[model samples]
Target: MQATKRPDFIDQQYDFAAYIRNPEHNAAPDGIETRRMAIYRDLFYNNIENFAASAFPVIRAITSDERWHAMIRDFMVKHHCKTPLFLEIAQELLDYLQNEREPQADDYPFLLELAHYEWVELALSISEESAIGEDVDPNGDLITGIPQLSPLAWPLSYHYPVHRIGPEQIPDGETETHLVVYRDRHDAVHFLEINAVTARLLQLIQQNVAASGRELLESIATEMNHPQPQQIVSVGAEILLDLRHRDLLTGIHNIPER
Candidate 1:
């Protein structure tokens, strides 16, 4: 069958939206007054700009107005967001920063990482998932059982120390940063900066989901080639307990840890 022609009204809608997105290149649809078109342009742009501004306030604060407006324009012109919902603007901004936005000479080195860290905070804050589900025992023994990471808890690693990126404390050098972002039972989101060992331990739990706490620690000890495996296991037990206390874990696995 031959391809069906698109209706003129559909094409007109596309033309209108394209111009609103980037009036610099695409011409305004015919028969509309420039003054009226200006109103539509400003209204559309302002709504998007304002929502994205609230979504990424730190980005707004750290960025100079001229630079920030220029970048936001770049986002509007280049990125095709999948959703029109205001709540998803932060995620769209993060996607633009990571995948689409071209780097500028004045762009901060930590810009992408900072955006990701902030996006995680915002995403977890609005997530509907419960911290401790019925399957998870809030008071379960973490050391003797197979500990499970919570769905609400996200383990993240970055080359830059994103949590400390601010006006006065801007980092000039790279530091390996590991954080577990989680929402607590009280419905508060928190970021916990952890050492490489603890980060690796969390990874181990996810990898060996059926392994008991002692087994996981032993595996870590073996991975580290430590001569004193028992000591590593002992310390790891305490670490598991600490994570459990902080609601970082979803209690012990339902299957037997032994």
Candidate 2:
């Protein structure tokens, strides 16, 4: 026996949703007034476009309105967002830019990286992770004790200076930009420009959470083959202290001297 057919109303609903999402591609459902359909389409598209503009203001500023609208419309029609949360929509755009969408001639070189930088700020602002525990000493020793990088801290490396990119300063040549983005106890998100050495040091600390400041510095000094290993150690000590003060390194694990 043949299976029963689905209701026409269901098909109509699907057609309507598709049209609302991408009126440029999908025609409006039959029997819907053109005026009413226009309202729905405008409302849906405007909401998404506004959200995207607010999330990536730099991108909005750089792109022409026609181009921006087309881009957002394409994203709305093509991208299948994973999360229902509105805040995650920015992430969906980032994923779309990074993985799904092909690079267009008019697109900025740092478009994806800049979107990612913006999304990081939003993600950190809404993060549920608590600050360092009360038991952790903020002013603990840097050399002897194990250093713990905060879950809120993130080390980011980009091919372009995403933080500095704007309508005026566009990327010209190949340049590596390293940044550390973190949230402090006050619930404020901060961005810090870092050098390759500092970036590598943060990476090492993140990978080896149990390593002491001195041990990490010694490894770095050895890696660099510095003429003055002691100087590296001294500077590393200062860096760790500064990181701790900024709440990026929550605290140190106090271990008794051997």
Candidate 3:
């Protein structure tokens, strides 16, 4: 049998992979030929690591710096993400926490929501497409006439008030927050605190239910034992008018188009 001879490419590629993963693996190439390759590999990983660190300051703040760096190192080794956008890195971290990380749900049930809420702000700001609400009649009764929500508007209730989430305020048990997240006519993001009834009403209108704004208000009033559709609509219409003035209504026109 011929004597075994190591291929040059095998040695180079081995050094390349190791140098890429960590600088400590740098072995003298016995020549200046391979030194430049190792330097380039280290620089590439450093740039990537720095970018990830900057993109996720809140997450980084939640962990010790050493732990944070270690976390990023392991993540780089294990996961292959599809997006090159640094803003999307939080999404990947969230997915990892949900599927792979073992953070206790009782103590950190809101971790996922916090990440998502933070990401939402960035997502809306960078979205390439935008939409504005359709024509709406402010004088029309909402409970009697079906009201349509803006396509850019959303009502989201999270298990935790993620806006308040941080290392200091994170509760030891589950919490909930009711919020309306929407984009205005100028495409700026706006968030509001809303009650359960209002959130449900928005959901119903968004689903294109036949109930009019006045009818919905009356239902809310009845639940509170007020039982007056007209009064309820009067108050609800004022609220809807404010939302419309703010461009939160996609369309509020009454039926029959008069």
Score every model by TM-score.
0.91, 0.94, 0.71
lDDT of 1 by residue, 1-258 (tens): 999999988898998989998999999998789999999999988988898778777777788889988888888899998997888988998899999988988889989988988889889989888666566766777776678888788999999998877766778899999999998888888999999989999998877657778888888899999999999988988888888888888788656533
Question: Against the correct fold, how does model 3 do in TM-score?
Answer: 0.71
Candidate 1 error regions (>4 Å):
1-5, 254-258
Put the candidates in TM-score order, highest first: 2, 1, 3
lDDT on C-alpha atoms for all candidate structures = 0.86, 0.88, 0.67
- Flag the better candidate by TM-score, 2 or 3: 2
Q: What is the lDDT of candidate 3?
A: 0.67
Measured by TM-score, the strongest candidate is: 2
lDDT of 2 at 195: 96
Residue-wise C-alpha lDDT for candidate 3, range 1-258, written one tens digit per residue: 998999998887776665565555455444446668667766777776676556555665676777666666656555666788777776676566556665543334565676666666666666664454356664555556778777667688897776666678656666667887777877789888887767766776777656777667777777778756577668777877776666666556566644
Per candidate, the number of residue pairs that clash is: 0, 0, 8
The regions of model 3 sitting more than 4 angstroms off are 1-55, 104-107, 133-145, 219-231, 253-258
Better model by TM-score: candidate 1 vs candidate 3 = 1
lDDT by residue for model 2 (128-233), tens: 9977855566778878887888989999999998998788988796589999999999999999999999999999988974678899999999999999999999
Which candidate wins on lDDT? 2
